[model samples]
Structure formats: structure tokens, C-alpha cells
Target: MPSFDIVSEITMHEVRNAVENANRVLSTRYDFRGWKPL
Candidate 1:
């Protein structure tokens, strides 16, 4: 059997890194082209 750990502990660098990665991925998302925030 295999197991995975969904970490509950994170550092500021990790959070910043994740946000940067998400921004990079979303930047190329066609559906997000005209998306607006509320």
C-alpha cells in the first residue's frame, strides 16, 4: 500500500512559492482571461 502526506505545516517561503506557482499556471488559463474579482 502507498500513503501520502498532506502537510499541515508550512513556512512563509512555501506559501509564497505556492502563490507564485498558482499565478504562473493561471496566467496561461484561457478561461481566466476576462475573470474579475469581487
Candidate 2:
């Protein structure tokens, strides 16, 4: 038999990293320039 357990700390860490990478890409892209926050 096998058992599994999920601890959200690891999941959250990965999510945070993904968001950071996405933000970095969006900020550096030329098309994103002049986009104002609402």
C-alpha cells in the first residue's frame, strides 16, 4: 500500500517563484511599456 500527504508550503513556494518569473518577463518586454496601472 502507498500513502501520500500534501503540505502546501512547497506548493506555495513554487507558485511564488512562477509569479516572480512571469513578472520579470512582463516587465522587461517592450510591448508592456507604457501600460498604466488602473
TM-scores of all models?
A: 0.60, 0.61
Whole-model lDDT, model 1: 0.84
lDDT of 1 by residue, 1-38 (tens): 99998879879999999988987788779988766545
* TM-score (C-alpha) between model 1 and the true structure: 0.60
On lDDT, the candidate that comes out on top is 1
The total number of steric clashes, by the backbone 3 Å criterion, in model 1 comes to 0
Which regions of candidate 1 deviate over 4 angstroms? 1-7, 36-38
CA-only RMSD, every prediction: 5.0, 3.4
